[model samples]
Target: MRHLFLNGPVQNGPFTFATRPGKAVGIRLAAALNAILGLPPTPHLWNTVTLAGDLRHREADGPTIPRQRFEADLITDKYPPGQFPVGGIMTDTDAEVARLALEMIENNLCAGTLTISRETVPSCRACGHMTGTGSHPCNACGSTDTEDRTGLHLVAELAKDRPVLDRSDIHASHRQQPRHLQNTAGNVAERLILSRTRDHGIDLSPHGLDGLVLDPRVGIHVTVLAAARRHEADTAVMTITENAANHIAAHGQHFREHGGARLQYALHGYLPYDHTASLQPLHEAYRATQAIKESFETWFLPLFSLRTKTATSPEQLPALFKHYMRAHLAQPAEVNAAAFNAVQHAVGAGNVSWITNKQGLANVMAARRAPIPSAAGPAHG
Candidate 1:
């Protein structure tokens, strides 16, 4: 199958990638794997259809900017000057994503997997925002008073024949499957309300569910599929955290596949960016150059996260760096065609074992260097 790795849509919160490097793990992981597979860069996906976004826009002091422009500007700020992604950016509420989401929703509604019905939910008494089922004050207006409000909502009926998130929904080898995520993702109610009160989102008004938007959880799925569709990929592998996958999997049940394209989560772990400074001594010892340091931080670290599917502890940094330096040092004088092909095949087949194997990593690194022979000079480290 033709596959492409895409980051799980990131929330457009107020944070720069420089300060919060952890947030870019998914994006970096997807980019690394896609590069290994020889796929062109894919647009970085962002989830701008968030309540936080709405609140931020509302509270901004100035002549009002369009919500779309406001989100675009915020996303652009995440990257450093002149360092935006080469593949460009795509927000969850982009026109193409909205179109795809509505199409999927319609198909689900027709197939009895989704329905539009009146739902009674808690609402902030002061601001008329949906407060969900919590005792805390409203997130939008910080009001303590809430009331049970009834309104039209788009609902999804979880598939009766299968779990919300099964093995097929994940992009991992059988032995590496995430059982905990599967169990927890299936723990939600049988019926899920898929519409929300948002000032900006994939508007459900097109389907007669006026004043509501597609749930961001589900919209994120469509965003991935929409990006895959653009590239004509049959399978879109989304790099996401296990916790995030569990939170959104249930809502994305009926939205994972469309037009012969399927979406699957590739669960990854957090990196210890805070402890990366610990590698300073190693950098000195290895005489690492800026390129080598960047390659380790942006490429190898993310790929490593796939192997260690939980947080990579601060203590593990030294060992991980040593392993990386070993691979860097062992990078073959020339690409091994057979080994390179094997690594590509393994990447396509969702086998991450090669990442931890020194020889395999060397061969893959050789392959990465092959395209630009002039740039394949010995690593200064």
Candidate 2:
């Protein structure tokens, strides 16, 4: 599995560890105890020590002390000036024990780890190549001076192995930080850099057996990455909507009559979040001429109205107009001119009649057969 090793403050949602030493202590404790107990050890005891109860308490011989302090006291169980010779090995053994405990804690935190995105990609003094993988000699210039980097390849690998994705989205600073393990409050700079670098041109693949290496340099250009991500997200969403439309077109008329709101909701979430940027090229190559916007609306609206048990929202009117335009602009589809005319006519400008009635036609014909209007108001017949 893709493992992420971070050396920093651990923030589990609302809870935060006050000190780094606390984290170190926990890791060291886990490691030491595991070694002493042997593999496949009993769980009840380990759970009791590490997770169940607090171990920092003084023996009934003295004043109460914190668990850590009490544990220390046990090793140095001495006081005052002693006139007798003491064991040489007992000199400051408490400090040694504390140090060992910390090491064990660190080991436990990192045990069984196949690969870590944070440590694999180290920062360089020169060009920022955060990913651990680099061409043996720089591929760009065939020089040995090139640095390796990492990014999405690691994320992809983690996804494949199912590492219980704690957090997929991170701020730019979090990405830049080497030990971005907290899964929250990460280095945003690193994320943006990696995203941009990859966007320009970079292959991101995991670098472990059934896992991937993540590079930190990929955070360079966030704007480009965001744009690309949005495009891709949009395309996928639209594809689904189009498929829904196609299904309705082929299967039955009910969807065609009442599916606008459903389609709207789908597009609402899909469009802004799409990842693929270049859609026009795909459309042109396929010679697609369907009015997707209108089709989507037609399918969604009726269904939405039925579910809500109310008329369409007034706010939706403008959106419908925009959809109408999008549906008609592309070559694959044609808007119904009659329907458009009817709506326009309801407004003042289009209400005038363009056609002449029979009486008007007759008057025109008679006028051509007779003389023009007289000067004195009206001439005698």
Candidate 3:
């Protein structure tokens, strides 16, 4: 396949899709695009490596359960009963992802782009957790006692000749390039430490950094690539918010491409899910069906977020719903091969214009109604 859309691994936090639908925007957007392209549903990716996760695990059951099982259970709980993802779920700490990450790190080290060297960092004396900067107790153990400890770390030297994030790193059209994100992401220290003290993650001990794990920011990229590799896609388009992209772009500089698959971020805006209740009146007015309601909430809104690239206003819901209804009504009885092909091409090119075009939207709606080979199997988690 030419391209596959994947979510920038959603953090495995304590929340359900019903309570926080906004968190699933990336997953919904990717699924919509993949369905449009007639590609099999790709696995929903998750980021299980986090300081918060470590503390939660430590506090619950006192490490009686395996960390991987704990994370998987949390991820499973996010979806409603019997409503898991169609293609399954992949976490950042998946064995395949960890292997691919180590391979990439080794390659970067060999090229002199990354090095394992001694560096001093703040550490919690009681818990041995990296305290990071500023004045604060350790997040893991809530210990005020900390010390500067020198240890081997995986370090990446920022490329002197290039901005940390450029147009090529983004999957949007030239006109929609995230210049602001590029500038801000570039404004970072010349060097970055890519290893962290995490209880559960892609362990760097195999690479000589004992007790350290590959930074989650970088592991997220590898997770996407690993998913793409499973599907043999050349381009892995990750749907992420501009803010999250800025936070992780620098660390993912060298991790974006590996083994012939290149990764790119498709920046999206936050949706006002809290205000979606306001749509109830419109739903009643339109006498919307269950499928129509889902299409509006999960598909159309997420796609619109890409075009907005900022928080989508709740005020726009009525008009957006009207637009979706119009498109749904205009869907041709017979699929338009030419129009459908054009829409697929646009999707692969990261073009959001098609999403707002009446004819293009109609064509997509028609395609969604038609049966495709990839849609034959039962949806998975």
Once fitted onto the true fold, the runs of candidate 1 whose alpha carbons sit more than 4 angstroms away are 372-381
Q: For candidate 3, write residues 27-63 as lDDT tens digits.
A: 9999988888888999999999999998899889758
The residue-by-residue lDDT of candidate 2 on 200-228, one tens digit each, is 11222222312221121111111112221
lDDT of 1 by residue, 23-105 (tens): 99999999988987788999999999988889899988732889999999999999999989999999999999998898898
Instruction: For residue 16, give model 3's deviation from the true position in Å.
Output: 0.3
- C-alpha lDDT values of all predictions: 0.89, 0.24, 0.90
**What is the C-alpha local distance difference test score of candidate 1?**
0.89
What range of 10 consecutive residues in model 2 has the weakest lDDT sum? Answer: 43-52
Q: Could you tell me the lDDT of residue 74 within candidate 2?
A: 34
Better of 1 and 2 by TM-score: 1
Query: Global lDDT for candidate 2?
Result: 0.24
**Number of clashes recorded per candidate:** 0, 62, 4
| Better candidate number, 1 or 3, judged by lDDT | 3
